[model samples]
Target: MSLLDDDAFPDMDSVSRDRVAPYIIRTEKRKAIDANGKPLFRPRRTQMAQVAWETRHHLQQLLYEAVTDYVREGYTTRPCARRNATSVF
Candidate 1:
């Protein structure tokens, strides 16, 4: 089953869990070690912050791209002004 299938993995709801799922699965299948086969510890706070920042930045870029695409496609519309400064009725 796919990891995105919530029914297959109900506990993968939290942001932290989603971020660490790949590492957790890899460690479970093999020894957690560095390139030199040395043991590794949990990621530091700064590392997690960097990951979060990158994720947020990527999402913002995607949203901006989608908006620009819509505008370029001429799908965006602006409402007409109901009144003008010089108009007198």
Candidate 2:
């Protein structure tokens, strides 16, 4: 029967005031690895990878500049990738 149906309610004539208790509860779950501060795993994001790629490209360009200008043509340097390409050699 529905709670709204008066017939479902404990009879007021027989039920005592102390007998009713519709209390509420709240909770937060802790995993097995729950620690004082650190999380078990780091969240995923794109900005970190973008920063790393920028650093790598900048370093590659600087090394290319140094090798082409300051070094001799016969001298061998670690090959760097060209634009839209995978490998230099």
Candidate 3:
């Protein structure tokens, strides 16, 4: 059974559509839930855009972390390709 056939897909109170590729999964602040103690209604139209932006930010942070880690610990190992995807020798 396809999820589309289900009512949940069409009538999702909160949903992220596929048009928002590379930003489908929402991870950014699209709606201000608490604005001066008021509930905020998030817009489905702009949710994708916000999520995309947040995804980019997260990727950058991860890249930085990876590079920093490599720089700090790279010298411990000799530069060479691994054999059989395990041993460097």
Best of the candidates, lDDT: 1
Clash number by candidate, in order: 0, 0, 0
lDDT of each: 0.50, 0.43, 0.48
Q: What order do candidates take by lDDT, descending?
A: 1, 3, 2
- lDDT by residue for model 1 over 1-89, one digit each (tens)? 23655554455233244444554544442357889977676644553343334665988878878889877654534322212211211
Q: TM-score: which is higher, 1 or 2?
A: 1
Question: What digit string (tens of lDDT, one per residue) describes model 2 on residues 1-89?
Answer: 12434554445332323333232233333332345765555555556443334665988878877778755543334243222122211
Pairs that clash in candidate 2: none
Count of backbone collisions in candidate 1 = 0
TM-score of candidate 2 to 2 decimals: 0.18
TM-score of each: 0.23, 0.18, 0.24
TM-score of 1: 0.23
lDDT of 3 at 9: 41
